[model samples]
Target: MNSVKKIAMLMCIGLPAFVHAGEAMVKWHDFNDYRDVRATNQAKGSYHKQIASSIEKHAIKLAEQLPKGYKLNLEITDVDLAGDVSYRGANEIRVVKPIHFPQLTLNYSLMNETGKEIGKGNDIKLKDMSFMDKIKMGRDESFYYEKRLLTEWFGEEILPKIN
Candidate 1:
C-alpha cells in the first residue's frame, strides 16, 4: 500500500506540467467610461463588474486555441453591449432592439514562448450589427452576443494572423 501511495503522489506531482497550456492576459479599461453595459431588470448588483469578468473569462477561453507555448495579451479599450436600456412597469430593462448592437475596441499582441511578438493589432474594431440574425447554440448563456463577437474575431482575425 505504501508503494502504491508513492506512485500516486509522483503522478500527481507531474500532472500540472501536462495540464499547462497556452495562456492569455486580458486587461480592461475603466468601466465608467465605457459606451454601454447596462444590466437587465433582473440584475442584482455590480453589473459592470459582472460583464467585465465574463468578457475576461471568455477571452481566456478563446486563447486556448493558440499553440501550447504561445501567449495572448488583450487590452479592451471600449465596450457597448447589444441592447438599449428602457423602463418597463417602473423597472429598468435592457431591450434588444434592432438598432442596438454589440461593439468593442481592443488591442492585442500574440507572443511566443521566447517573448517575441508574432502578431499584433491596434485599435481593432469589432462590431456585430447583425448580432441578432445569427443562430445561437447557447441562447440562455450570459453575454451571449458579446461572447460570440469575441469568438468570431479571435477565430477569423487573430488565428489567421498567427497561423
Candidate 2:
C-alpha cells in the first residue's frame, strides 16, 4: 500500500513535467515595416520619430513576455496620425490627437528554430496613444496603461487559443 501511494505521487509529478517538456517553444520574428510613415509624412519629422520609437519599444516588451515555447512576430503595416489641440485652462496648451497608433498586422507563428509554424496569431492589434500623450503621462504611466490594455486584450483573444 505504501509503495502504491509513492508510485501514484511520482506519476502525478512526472506526468506534468513530461507534458511541459513536449510543449512548443516560441521564437519571435522581427517586425517587418510594411509601410514607412516617414516616407509619407514629410512635415512632422520629430513627432513621427517619437511615435515610431514608442511603437518599437512597446512591441519589444510585449514580445519578450510570451510563453517559453510560443513566439509573437510584429510588423507595422499602416500608420495614421491625427492631431487635436485643446486649451488647458486659461493660458495652457494641450494636444489630444488621434495618433492612429500604427496598425501592426502581425504574422505570429509558433515554431521551433527550424521553420515549421505550429500555430499562428495572424492578426493582432497593437495600438498606442499619440506621442504627446506619452510625454504628458510619462514613460511609466504609459507603460502601465499599455501593459494592462495588452494583457486584457491578449487574455481575451490569444489566451483562449492557447488553453
Candidate 3:
C-alpha cells in the first residue's frame, strides 16, 4: 500500500477511540499567586499559559482511565515546577536539583456515570522529592517532572477511589 493510504487507514482505525476517550476538566487558580512557574527566559505571559496547557493535557491523558461516562475534575491551586531559574552568564537557565522538587496543590473530585461524586479531596498536595532518581523515558519532553508527578498521583490517589 502507498504511504498516504497506510496513514489514512491507521487514522481511520484510531479516530473513534481518540474521539471517545475521556477528558478531565482542569481549572487553574490565579497563576499570579502560585509559588513558582518560571519558564527559562520567556516572559510570564506566554510561559504560564504553556504550563497550564501542559498540565491540562496530562490530566486528560490520566482521565482516559476512567470508565465510560465517568469524569475527573481538577482545580489546581498552586504549582511549583521542578527547577529553579538562575543566570548562566547572559543567559538564564533552569537548574534542576534535589531541593527544587516539583509540587502541586489541588482539589479533585471523581464523578460516576450518574453524576454522583464518588471521591473528592480539597487542598491535596503532591510532591516528588525523588524525581531525579525515578525512571523516566522522555527526558526532553515538556514539564517532564511535573507530568511524572501527576502520573504517580493519578495512579495512587485517584485510581484507588474508583475501584
Q: Which candidate has the top score in lDDT?
A: 3
lDDT of 1 at 31: 79
The pairs that clash in candidate 2 are 24-69, 25-69, 26-69, 26-70
- For candidate 3, lDDT tens digit of each residue in 1-163? 9999999999999876764455599998888899998777888888999998988988998888777777899999999999899999999899999899999999989898789999899999999899888877855888999888889899998788777
lDDT string for model 2 (57-155, tens) is 655555444444555444434433332334556532324345534233444554433445545665566555543355334345322443444445555
User: Candidate 3, residue 8: CA error in Å?
Assistant: 18
List the candidate 1 regions with Cα displacement exceeding 4 Å.
1-20, 42-45
**Which consecutive 10 residues in model 3 have the weakest lDDT in total?**
14-23
Best of the two (2, 3) by TM-score: 3
Query: What CA RMSD would you report for each candidate?
Result: 4.0, 9.8, 4.1
TM-score of each: 0.83, 0.41, 0.85
Runs of candidate 3 exceeding 4 Å displacement: 1-20
Model 1, 50-115: lDDT tens digits are 887888888888877776788999999988988888889878888887699999999999998788
Using TM-score as the yardstick, the better of models 1 and 3 is 3
What C-alpha lDDT values do all the predictions have?
0.83, 0.46, 0.87
